[model samples]
Target: MGKPAKNKEVKPKRNRITFETKAKIIKLKDEGKRNSELAKMFGYSTSTIATIYNAKSKAIVQRAVEECVPQGVCVFKTEYRPTVLNDLDTILYEWFKRNEGRKVALTMTALQCKARSIFAILMDPAHGIF
Candidate 1:
C-alpha cells in the first residue's frame, strides 16, 4: 500500500488594494463604470467597488482622490486625536531636541525618572505646575 502525494501548488501572494486604487475605483465608477466591470478591472470583489462607489459623502470621495498623489494617500476620518499625554509628548520631544548630538544621551531610567517627576508635579495641586 502506497500513500497518495499531496498537491504542492504554491498560492500567489494576496495584494492589498491601496488607498490610491480605491480612489481610482471611485473615479471610474463616477465615469459610469459598473461594479462588475470595476471588480474585473481592479481584481477586487464587486462589493468592494460598490462600497467605494456608493460612499455616502461626496466630500470624503473627493478628499481621497485629491490625496492620491505620488507622495502619500489620504484616509478619511482617521486623524490622530489628542490625548492627555500630549503635553508630556511635547516636553519629551523638546528634551530630545535639546540633548541631540550630546556625548551622553539620557538613559531610559533617567527619562522614566524625569517623566515620573513631571507627572507628580502636574498632579500636585500645591505646586501649580501645569
Candidate 2:
C-alpha cells in the first residue's frame, strides 16, 4: 500500500494589533471617532478596527479588572475557559456602577480601556508583542 500523506496544519491568521495597540485603539474609539477614521489614523484594516468595536474576545474583560479589581477581590489566571466572560461581565458591571457618569461616555471609556489591553493579548502570539 502507498504511504499516506501527512496532514497539513493550518494556522489562524495573525492580527497586526497587539494588546497594547488595542488599548490605544480602544482609547481612540472611546474619544468618539468612527472606525474608518481610526483605521486610517492607525494604518490598520478597517475590518480589524471594526472587530475591536464589536468586542468579541473575552480577554478584554479579563484585563479590565487587572488594575481596578480590589486586592483579594478577584484573581485572574492564564487559563482559557468558556464561562470566563460571564464572570468578567459581573466584575466589569460592578466597575461600571462604581464610576458613574453619562452612560454613553462611561461605556465608551470602559470599552476603550479594556480593548486597548485586550488587543495587546491578541497580538502577542502572532506579532511577538505583549
Cα RMSDs, all models: 12.1, 20.5
Worst 10 residues of 2 by lDDT: 73-82
Backbone clashes in model 2:
8
Candidate 2 lDDT (Cα, 0 to 1): 0.65
**What is the per-residue lDDT of model 1 for residues 51-94, given as tens digits with 9 covering 90 to 100?**
77776365375555555642222233364222325666777777
Q: Which stretches of candidate 2 lie over 4 Å from their true place?
A: 1-13, 62-130
Clashing pairs in 2: 18-119, 18-120, 19-119, 19-120, 19-121, 20-120, 22-116, 23-116
In model 1, residue pairs whose N, Cα or C atoms come closer than 3 Å (at least 3 residues apart or on different chains), thus clashing, are none
Shift of residue 108 alpha carbon in model 2, Å: 53
Mark the 10 consecutive residues where model 1 has the least summed lDDT: 71-80
**Residue 30 Cα positional deviation in candidate 2, in Å, after optimal superposition:** 1.3
Candidate No. with top lDDT: 1
Supply the global lDDT for candidate 1: 0.68
Candidate 2 residue-wise lDDT, 49-108, digit = tens? 888867735448756754566433326454423244554566566666666654545657
Q: Report lDDT (Cα) of residue 21, candidate 1.
A: 79
